[model samples]
Target: MAESRSCDEVLKAAFPSIVQKDEVQKEFSHFLVSKDLLPAITRYLHTQPGLHGRLTLLWAVDNRPTRNTYGLHYLFTLEPSHRWMLLSAELAGNDRLFPSITPHIHAAQWYEREIRDMFGLIPQGHPDLRRLVRHEHWPKGTHPLKKDFLWDHVLGRQQGEHHFRRIEGEGVFEVPVGPIHAGIIEPGHFRFSVAGEPIMQLELHHFWTHRGVEKLFEQQTLTAAVPLAERVSGDTTIGHSLAYCQAVESLLHLEVPRRGRYLRSLFLELERLHNHLGDVGAICNDTAYALPHAHCSRMKEQIMQLNDRLTGSRFLRGVTRVGGVAIDLTAAQLAEIVAEMDRIEQDFSELESIIAHNASLIDRLETTGVLTERTAWDHAVVGVVGRASGLDQDLRRDRPFAAYDELPVKVVNYRYGDVRARMRVRMDEIHESMRLVREVRLKIPQGPVAGEPSRVAQTGEWALSAVEGWRGEILYMVTAGENGTIQRCKVRDPSFVNWPAIQWAVIGNIIPDFPLINKSFNLSYAGNDL
Candidate 1:
């Protein structure tokens, strides 16, 4: 295991080209390896015992203007140690090619394709190099994320249909659903190949709502990027904003006030509370049980009202800033929040009991949309989806960000890996979040909510922030440009990772059950599309 080996020992064994090891943040270790060794090192880290072989993120940075090279970063976390190891490689000149890790690591599939679509960096051995982020109408050879590409440039649309893979067999038929759904949900195309009632294969197509968020980040000032980050995903405002703020704070070496940390945690838990409450109810709604679903909506609405009372926004936007929070909670507001927590908990308990005693709802959820533990790991699923599938990894407890470091988190996990299991995880999490909010309110310190923003250092530095959002782990990687401006910001929403698992989960289930299975996961289309 990488945990037992010292940094020097691991470096000596791996023989990386350039190593930057820091002791202050034991969770991080950076290495610059040659492009040729990239795949081998990645495979080694993933296959080795005690390392847990989890690939957290794979992203590319366009450094052609400054460094005359495109840099690739592979972020991995070793279990038990909770340490992050980054393997980086540079593709110089016109030979922008690197071996694809997807063949060995299934989770790297979409990432590799995304690099091909956005940066024009070819993953040489990638099995399927079709466009991932860019739509079929997008002009060929137009890589939007490249340094030479204009942020606001518009391209003429080309008319063509995306070719989805077809399954050939007796009694096999295809059903295509929504790039535009009947509901007000975001756009995503799902092609399901079915044999009678059972799904044979499912192919998903997203990026319909791709808004050039990363390109927009390149245009914003360091301080001005927080609000933009908050808007990355409407449901995950706190998660994305907090992750961005933490990354900037890490780069500037700024310490948030103790009270501010608690407040941030409080906001995070509140965000989790409403989201989980709504998801639990939505799962019940999928079973045609409207009572629990309506009750869940009511509870969620109450939480949002509380959020509006505490922060200025219903979704808790604009509350997070670089170095600390934008606002502090008054004593009266804190007391009200505590009282709200009690009511929410009590109400949630009653609603949970009602859903649990419903045999029909249980039948609809249990043994349906089962995402096995193996499938979950292969896709690198996270959050409630990953927890329900028996993956014992949670960033809050494993990485310990914000007030989570001071307050213990009770991670809820289930081995069933079904819709019921996923709902149960959310049910347990709601209580856990309520308990955390109470703890934060009782122990919150008295101090200023925010610290002065530190002057941007001219040095080019990179930092990573991971937040355990309600859906899953939200990761942000930021690199400082000249004069402390952001050179590049890579956002990895949990939905981006968990969406792939849905295809596998729906394999044995009937077509009608697809909606129920999909709701069980409840991924964010906007977040994934971004």
Candidate 2:
């Protein structure tokens, strides 16, 4: 497995583009490199002929002692079997200026800005270096993730300084989208410079409901943080849970039971199957394809209902605790699940095939939101978006954690990087998830599901845990040896990396089609807001 390669080997293979490489600590490989080399390094790994840089996750950490953001860490997981390495590059704090990986690795844009916004570390030459998940009136230098940023002082943060930016051109009319929109979804503002519907420039502002999730998690205990993590994004409970649990497991060195491991994978795929169905249906609904949209939404509801019946929560919350799975499956339920999956898979396949062949449906999605392979990698897309764009970097198959390590799993990849390609990947993955579910159900072992977590975590140690979430790789890095609670925690959603790639897709497209393209990516606003 490429997961087995040492930090030394990874460094040696991709040495020229890399400036400084070494192990930061066990399980976390760290690299210090020139800022100018980042875009080149992004291309070296993420968009190379083969998968050299399969972006795992990119997040910035606030070093408590220094009271400043220490490093902008980008984890690029490598393709195993091939003689390649995933670049884990970090641009240091003092020399905060870094080149835009957006030009080379499309997914890195938002990550760079998120780091830019939260840490105040600017990506010097970035192309659309706009503020994300930060308010327009929130004061210039008040980065929330910093140690000194006090929420209690919110009422007195010096709000008004005439913060105005220009969208000037000869005939360039300004279009202001919402901090509050017509839809009931969360609020975000989009300012576009347009000449007749063709987008001349676009600016996205994303801090409508900030919620302060990272800071909130810092205040709560491990068990208490579970609910916050579960609520980080409404639908990604399992994904966030798995990432957090893996972090705890590494901390305590707990070996989850075979049964618990299988159950974990089962619940995760269940998460994937349902979300992808809902998202795919949503994309069609945006395209005005009612029949398929209705059918797919109904089918998706069935998937969620299955989770409610089995896990006792519609979104599968609390089923996964720190050490292992909180709920165990019975043999009879497993058999029934296998039987039900067999039928559900067939129904979905038929409905999807009908939708795929419809002429109007094809016309709507054939070339819309075209994110090329080069852009997809540069932006460090994950899950459906990355897979569809031919990035082919799935954490499950590559890293093989939990029950997935024992099973035969394939990462479905599509090359065109358009709306149809994104939809097709989600469709194929639904089938693959179904097959895995059946196999896991049959192989369900008899054992205890939960492990008792240790009362105290050892001090001053660092650990990283990664799980292949339905969306993409979910990363959780921790450090807490000095105190009773977490000293520093960095949470990264795939959208942190993927959201900026949409900027490229929106360029030159009709304004109305932007929604279609955006839905195809279907990035989590809630996840990004945190």
Candidate 3:
């Protein structure tokens, strides 16, 4: 094989036409590449050993009615350097066709499909150009992201059909689940191609809760959008809100106070603790092992109660603001949190002991729903799922944010890629989160929790913010419009990336075990739809 080369070296040798764009933001290095050459460059950046880049996100901005064009931005995280590279390409007013990178980069598949649905930009060589975000009822030719499309515009429903892929063979049959499900879960449809008891293939249809969140962000002031971000996923309020705030802070060159930084990290870990605890119980419950499940639920409730006392919200909403945190921690509150962590840790230890001794639960989880490392990487899976599959990437350790740079963090990983492995990851992470909370109590400084913006947000300037949420990584990309108004806000929850992995993970598992496998990942339907 030929030697791997740096991005600059490759650009200089192969594509000199792609020039460096002026630096408009501090978060990433910007470059402007030809629309046709985008696929080739993306392949090199993603595959080349020297760069070791992972395609972080792909999004489009409508410059229509202003420049009569649509611009595409592909963000790549250089894994080796932990830095960001953004390649931008433009489609003229009349041209909506762009070469598809999905044929070479599998991770770009859903993003490309979403672009096609929302912006009417066609990916010429895409294998599947099926509507992703727009449901069957959405009118044809309705591109909601365009500048002329008002956020409040209502359109008449049009009849359409979504075609799902099918595998045909002698004994192959299809089993369809729901866009609506039992319990209080959100909507998602799962189709399984089965041969007797084993699944031949599994595919999921999501986006039932699509709320036009990105479009709603348009024209909203930075301060006013925090609550909006908080609601992106009810369970991930801190993750999404912090990601949004960090991007806005990046734009205004604002530095949160030391105390606020520690506080943010504490709250984020608390959020992780509650979610992981609940999932552990839910996964156990799926196996008919209700003892551990009940205890785990109790532990989760205690954490939520702690959150209510500390932040005045069980989900930790309304605490994160544009510059920093809206709430401050008193000495008594700090002591209370530390004491609570001690008690929860003890209770979790006993619960884990019970789970470990339960042979029936282990039998169900072990060797079930295995997602290989290659498959996880291909889907760009994040958080607990990716770690369980042996993808050793964590933003907290790889790209530290808040107080993570100061506090010690252990990235728990497992190579088995089974339901058991996923459960173990969450179990380990719960302990780690408790440790982080205690560390924050010790090292946090006394200071203001908020900071004032020192710089102005320039029009067309964009920044990216990433947080390692309980489930995995949450990314927010914010672009400024006139007078510091949001032009576009791109939110990427971990569920959006990991949802595709579940389909691959369930291939050989039995139909009855699907619930256990699904609960292992515990993805957010609301987050993915948004």
Candidate 4:
């Protein structure tokens, strides 16, 4: 790999008209570009070589009190440099309009729509400028995320309808699947345009479970927000909590204890282990294969029990605090965890063998619900979905955090871009996570599991953190207000980025295969709805 370049050097070389007043920190470099230059700059960063061209996050902040203007922050990661560049643009006066980059950067489609829905900031020139997060019942001209909007305020209901796109042709019909699912999953509606058995297009509408998580964070003190972060997505409790904690710790320039870092890594891997095991089974179950699903479920239950024994929660909630983890592992507990890893490895290996040899199962998975590499890149999918499509990027290795700097990671990737490729990536990752847990348990240093919490000084500062969750990269962007109160907290779950890719993934597949393809991606509606 080539030596990394500074953010300023890269920006100057790409766009010479860039101005001053930008902020550059160790974690990321912030730039302030004009509305007109936004699209050009975004396109350059995305298509340029070695820049990685991935939009980690894009969010709007109500900065009227401090700057008397609304601000938009666009965060991008350059993989080769392992650096993040944040482009900031302020919308002055009543116009609150900014040129949309969605035309050039396809991944900005939903982010732009979300800004329009939440902050009422218009993304001018956007192809589809429809309401995203706010559904039909939400009152018009009322933006929930604005600083002036009362958190507890409610408005009278209105009669409205969602206008889903239609396909006009002979023998063409639309199938609407649910904001209410058959299973116990969260609410999300999938509109499929199909002819007979084959699907022509798929459009997804979620946000039914949007709980105003970001708005709730604004009312929470610095320390009181960890629990909220843990609940961003129930299954990704550890990942979201760790990301939020790291961002807070970064702002304060606090370092966690070495032992705490190792413990955090162990908990993260344990979370990954359970989720991957359950997903493997779920995917098999979708294919009508019961034996592998049963075995995988058995192994997954054992890990969940171990989690409850180690931490207070089965999902590893309340384990991560701002400074460090809340609990430490005893020598006996470490030994037991390591022993459990051995048993899990043996059992999972047998399950993998059975899956590999089953001809019927193999036939169902191979080339089913294929998401081409082009589609993955256009949508900027991450985590297992990105890796399975040959986008070789993992935040743990690309940008190390917790104990990952000391304990290196080997990324698992495949180019098939099919259901089988995604399943293989998950299987390989389970083994990798188990190995990491064993290594951390054996080589972990004996020391305090947490450090003293730092006093956050009142300042206008922002911090960013990214963790490679089982699904993909979970990003947290935190900004501090007076007395260290959270002014704005933006979370970009992997589901948000990967959900759009599903529209393309299910294009050519049949209606019955939609469930299997959806399981292969295994996105979270609650996470995205936030």
Best prediction by TM-score? 4
Candidate 4: 10-residue stretch with minimal lDDT: 1-10
Q: Lowest lDDT 10-mer window, candidate 1? A: 16-25
Put down candidate 3 lDDT per residue, 1-530, tens digits, no spaces.
Answer: 12223555565566678877654654456789989999989988888877767788999999886788899999888777767788999998799999999998888899999999988999999998888999888998888888878899998898888788989989999999998777679999999999999998998888999999998899588768999999999999999999999999988889999899999999999999999999999999998889888898998999899899887899999999988899999989989998998998998898889889988879889999999998988887888999999988889998789988899698899999999999999999999998998889889999999998877898888788999999899999998888879999999999998998899999888999998899999999999999
C-alpha lDDT values of all predictions = 0.88, 0.74, 0.89, 0.89
Tens-digit lDDT string for candidate 4 (10-77):
77777887764544465566678887899999998998775766787999989887778898889887
Give me the runs in candidate 4 sitting further than 4 Å from their true place: 20-23, 50-52
TM-score of each: 0.97, 0.86, 0.97, 0.98
Give the alpha carbon lDDT tens digit for every residue of 1-530 in model 2.
34434534544487555544444444434556655666766666665545465656666666655543365566766554322233444444456665667666655666777778877877767776666657556677878777677745563355543232566768878788887776566777777778888887676666566788887776766544667777877778999988877876776667788888899999998899889888888888888877777888888888888888888899999888877888887887787777777878888889978886888888878888788887776565677888888887777876677799887788899998899899989888989999999889777778888787665667645567777788887778766634446655678777666776777777888788877888888877788778
> In model 4, what lDDT does residue 456 have?
78
Candidate 1 segments whose C-alpha is farther than 4 A from its true place? 1-11, 14-26
In candidate 2 the C-alpha lDDT for residue 288 amounts to 81
Root-mean-square deviation per candidate:
1.7, 3.9, 2.2, 1.4
- Candidate 3: the clashing residue pairs are 383-472
User: What TM value does model 2 have?
Assistant: 0.86
